[model samples]
Target: MTTELDLGSIRHAPKVLLHDHLDGGLRPDTVLELAERAGYRELPADEPVALADWFRTAAHSGSLERYLQPFAHTVAVMQTAEALHRVAYECVRDLAADAVVYAEVRFAPELHLAAGLTLPQVVEAVLAGFAAGQQDAAAAGTPIVVRTLVTAMRHAARSLDIAELAIDYRDRGVCGFDIAGAEAGHPPTRHLDAFEHIREYNGHSTIHAGEAFGLPSIHEALAFCGADRLGHGVRIVDDITEAADGGQRLGRLAALVRDNRVPLELCPSSNVQTGAVPSFAEHPFDLLARLRFRVTVNTDNRLMSDTSMSREMLRLVETFGYGWADLQRFTINAMKSAFYPFDQRLALIDDVIKPRYAVLIGG
Candidate 1:
């Protein structure tokens, strides 16, 4: 095995990201420019550096609602089709620079309809942007592939509409469907009809569960709504307990998740900032990884958490002593759990992920 990795080395390592929100990952300067172009006048700060800090501070306000308050500004600037295209293009470009070979970025189309653009227009704009970004990344020699996950806000009632939209564009660029928003009063079961429609079309889904809420939400997402993956399922640790002699006990729900090998899109920094867990040292990621659950590292919101895939992996490496082998395992796990086809996933692991790690580990 190779020695412990550092941030500079980690940044050069190939990565796969599965859980990033579009509205939550914009560059600070891009947000300022978009707001200015759209004549949005309520920005908390005019400068990019201050606006970036404002997002992080607002998200660290110790409440989920407070954490989400900054999105209103980001979404406000992303209403027009041109703005959507630029935001998506910049997302792929940034990820490529970070050495992310594969990613699935998510966004709620319904949220971008305020400026008279139809649902189809929003998806097409983002897809076109992804295409342009992918081409540019290829030309720059950091080639990356990106897919979209059409999301519907759970607090709203447009899940079925979004689910159908996801299927409509599945062959174009959309790869899956998801439900996001406040989870306290809005459970996954409330959108059972949407999940059912996706299942009927044999489509894939990941639900935001067990983050702000408890295990009941997770149960409904998996057993009830049939989610293929869990978004921010960090709270699954609630079902696991340590015994007197350091042995651990897994409750039924935890056992089921582990047994099924259900993918948990765990966002470390975002979880801490949103108060999903107490701190990084007490984060359940290490525990879940040791238990051999299908845990994947992710950046739920890059802007809010001020993170990238490299930063997230660096934090875990420092906290858990993860080496090159551990980093490779996490990358492969994310590739396997991707909504992309199995043949494509296998090719990436064999041709890209493995080869890249082999170089880093000095094979």
Candidate 2:
């Protein structure tokens, strides 16, 4: 019989992460040092541990705006190419340490232009960092491959430019395009031009929708924008209902999402921090998973949420008593949903992910 999995075993399992932010996953000490180096004095705390605590406390304010406040400092320090490269490099190191075999780290290039670095320079620096980190990880006997997702801030107007940037860098390290920011007033429809541009190029796009807003935002993202995936599509749950006879009914949107296999990049901890759900137990992940809604767990903001893929999986294991099979399923879901090419994704699933899980499950 398979034994209960511990944090150690979970950490050893090969994992795939699809929706992590480069600006949101910096090491606390790295942020502090970078801020000091860049003369950015707006950070709430000078010390690493205190700064980390401040970020976690501030992000839990139950408002997406409040949760996003820390990015000002992170983005401030990340304006320089050196800072961007270091942050992306450390992100790979951290994820590899967590046994993440593959990840797609995203950040908006427009936000990193405060230092006057060209957008291509910013992308090049980050790609170089990921390459360096991957090489280092391989040398250290824990190999990891990281790709980039070029995100355009939803509140900003540079999305079409950013889409072109993603397309330009597709063969480099960039894998996909995304628009992430507050989803309330800034709908994905506002970036329809960018979405259309990506579609024209036959590129992949994941829209940040249905998190701060509800079904309407999700509707525009899927029905209008044709998102390949939904970033933090947690609020898609709002379209689902339970009947008096204890049967669950999915509204048109939810049914379409499920039937079409649109991946929901559900970041449970980040969702709770952003007030998307009351708490873990109240989260719709289990419901969506039970209904087979192409659910995949993620760490949207590692620093702010004080989380990693392993911790996210462990929390689910503790809360829902998930087994090795459940964990493997989530890993495979994320791997399958990755914007990576189909043949390579399948190769990772069969050659890397499955063998690791089989060893853990004693199969």
**Top lDDT: which candidate number?**
1
In model 1, the clashing pairs are none
* Model 1 C-alpha lDDT per residue in residues 133-230, reported as the tens digit of each score: 99999999999999999999999999999999999999999999999988999998889999999999999999999998999999999998999999
Q: Would you estimate the TM-scores of all the predictions?
A: 0.98, 0.98
TM-score, predicted candidate 1 vs. hidden true structure: 0.98
After the best TM-score superposition of candidate 2, give how far the Cα of residue 282 lies from its true spot, in angstroms: 0.3
TM-score of 2: 0.98
For candidate 2, give the lDDT of residue 228. Answer: 91
Q: Which portions of model 2 miss their true places by more than 4 Å?
A: 1-3
Candidate 1 has an lDDT of 0.94
